[model samples]
Target: MIRGVRGATTINQNTEKEIIQRTEELLLKMIDANAIVAEDVAQVLISVTNDITACFPAKALRNLDGWDYVPVMCTKEIAVPDSLPSCIRVMMTVNTEVAQKDVNHIYLYAAQSLRPDLSKS
Candidate 1:
């Protein structure tokens, strides 16, 4: 079986360091929460909202984990009206036996507002 874990994070500033740190922090949480090991991950795709182009958030994770083995891709989020700015989002597809309800989905900072129900806010 395969499941997708969704997560998001925000940066207070548009600097490269802020982008990298916030992205790394959120991804680490997402991976830990869902018990996602390297072997289980099929692929990771990251998108940063239009306001963000300081860096590719996925690279931050790769650098943090020393992940020379994982495949990662990044793209710019679609520019929609009234969208949250400075946001980094990840969709990780993993091979897992866990049920969808048992999987953890992370939403942090302003992005949390989008999935308040899931976050139990």
Candidate 2:
């Protein structure tokens, strides 16, 4: 079976270091929560808010030791009026035996307010 794990996090600044750090943190939490391995990941789709332009979040995943071959992409989030800023969101598709309801969705930092019900805070 295939399932999608969703996660979101916020960075204090738009620097490449900040983007990579927060994105790596969120991806690690998602992997831990779902027991996901690099081989099982189908693709990772990352989107950052308009305010974030320093770098692509996918850079973090590629830098992971075993994730060199994992397919990942990064894009800009829709600029919805009055929406959260400096936010990075990810949807990771993976092949897994876990039931959809059992999958964990993570939201951290200021992004926690974006999905209070699913926030890991």
Candidate 3:
């Protein structure tokens, strides 16, 4: 079955380095939490707040082993008033045996506030 794993993180700045580092961290965390391998991933959808125009968050995966062939789509997150700034969000579609309810969704840094209900207790 195809399942979705979501994650979001806040970058300290809009610079390429910060975006890449934070995005990579978020992806790694999701992968580790869900035991997701590249072969299991169908596609990755990423969205960033309008304020972050420095680089595409998906580009951070380019240097990761086994991620070169994975399909990734990046876009600007809808600009909402009072929304968290420098937030990068991702939704990865993966073919996995795990039940949907068992999947891990990670939210870190300021982005954690975006989904307080999903936060780890």
Candidate 4:
């Protein structure tokens, strides 16, 4: 079976260093929580708020030890009025035996408010 693991995180700045670091941190937590393997990931779709323009968040995934071949795409999040800023969201589709209800979604920093029901913190 295939399932989607969702996660989000926020950054204080739009620098490449900040974006890459936070994105990598979120993805690592998601992988650990879900027990996901690089080979099982079908694709990763990352969306960042319009305020973030330093670089693609997908760059973080590619830097992972075994994720160089994983498919990753990055885009801009929709500009909703009064929405969260400097946010990066990720939807990772993977081949897993885990049931949908068992999947874990991670939200970090200020993004936790975006999904209080799903956020572990």
Question: Considering summed lDDT, which 10 consecutive residues are worst modelled in model 1?
Answer: 59-68
Q: What lDDT tens digits, residue by residue, belong to model 2 across residues 1-121?
A: 9999999999998899999999999999999999999999999999999999998989999878899999899988889999999999999999999999889999999988988987757
Off by over 4 Å in 4: none
Ranking by TM-score: 4, 2, 3, 1
Instruction: Give the winner by lDDT.
Output: 4
TM-score of every candidate relative to the true structure: 0.93, 0.97, 0.96, 0.98
Instruction: Record all residue pairs in model 3 with backbone atoms less than 3 Å apart, i.e. clashing.
Output: none
Instruction: Judge candidate 2 against the unseen true structure and give its global Cα lDDT, from 0 to 1.
Output: 0.93
Which residue pairs clash within candidate 2? none
Local accuracy of candidate 4 as per-residue lDDT tens digits, 3-105: 9999999999989999999999999999999999999999999999999999989999988899988989999888999999999999999999998999999
Question: Which parts of model 3 have CA positions greater than 4 angstroms off?
Answer: none
Say which candidate scores most in TM-score: 4
lDDT of each: 0.85, 0.93, 0.91, 0.95
lDDT of 3 by residue, 1-121 (tens): 9999999999887899999999999999999999999998999999998999988889888868999999999998888898888899999999999998888899999888988978662
Better structure of 2 and 3 per TM-score: 2
For candidate 3, the 10 contiguous residues with the lowest summed lDDT are 112-121
- In model 1, the clashing pairs are none
